[model samples]
Target: MLISGIHSRPKYAGLRVDRSGTHHIILSDTPRDIARMVEGLEPAPGPTEVWTVVGACTVTAAEERGPDGSVVRRAFRSRPLMFDMLGHRLARESMGLRLYAIGEEAFLWDVAALARSFGVDGDEIQLDHAGSERRRVFCVHCRAMTENVRTNIVACVGCGAHLTVRDHFSKRLAAFMGVQADAEVRGDLPPVEEIFR
Candidate 1:
């Protein structure tokens, strides 16, 4: 269901550990993301630390042992706590620190934005997407965000307008733009489909 030729859509190039990195911080939500992020870097030159959210979706992020002698693992109760820890770590460490953000698009970009707040450029961090194609949609009429939208058309939570989720994505907003789908035709609207999975 992912549309090609959309420049705004994020590119999820697989993660490859930087050989020159002295320390690595992996932040992921799903086990798949963790495995993908740590695919390489076997016998890592430096220590690796994993900061993952142990929610209902994640059984145990600590089960993944790093190639570099047991990785220091920290599990959080929620995404906010995990991201808070990431922010603190980013604020403290600067040199020789490589960060990996792995999860869905929303989680990946959220990490990137937080890193930016601490003066870390997106280029400095490695991002690998995993799990779910659900989208956070931004309503054009009211500027309200409708989260976890898996269908093509949804009712805007803010203005009650029926919206068509567009492929055009906004990195700054961390959401796809949704436009009113039935404004011109009034009651006439296309059939909504659950394409994003």
Candidate 2:
């Protein structure tokens, strides 16, 4: 149901009693993460449909095999297409679905966003990161989205303003808030340090 200050929509009532839906496993192109994800597939509640986005690399033999000898689905392209497939799957299957994603932070966030749009609660989704915490930042200046931002001090891709990435995360934007980094003193720049490492 509607929890105050939380979700406006009612909670999935069947979440507690229903555990028989298909498990959708979305994995990134990382080999190590794929292997680890495969190992963690045990104890799943029901039938699982696996999808992996293979970038430039090929999926290993082990990764090609599913949890119980079934063939895992493969998408040989970028993360955008993978997310599209996930969105379509979530649209087709509305209930009793669980999502398990293993990938980089940005990629996982993309999946989570799509899942949320399809009414999948956070508890129904599990995530694991295979890479560092490079973030996606939304610049308030020129209203542009910057990806793979690895530092607190980032140059706005749109306005060219040096922005300080804030800890605040916007679910709607799916990015961190960024403000002008040198607002106090126009030319005084903050000490640069690698963040989300």
The numbered model that scores best in TM-score is 1
Error of 2 at 105 (Å): 2.2
| lDDT tens digits, residue span 4-96, model 1 | 477888887788888677788888875454644566756654788878776764543344564555677777777887887777778788688
In candidate 2, what are the lDDT values of residues 7-106, reduced to their tens digit?
A: 3212222112125545555455444444344454555545555666666545332335554654365654667667776677778885666676676666
Best by lDDT: 1
Candidate 1 to truth, TM? 0.87
For candidate 1, the per-residue lDDT at 15 reads: 84
Q: How do the predictions measure up, each by TM-score?
A: 0.87, 0.75
Which regions of candidate 2 are displaced past 4 Å?
A: 1-22, 35-40, 43-45, 57-68
Query: How far is 137's C-alpha from truth in model 2 (Å)?
Result: 1.0
Question: For each candidate, what is the lDDT?
Answer: 0.78, 0.65
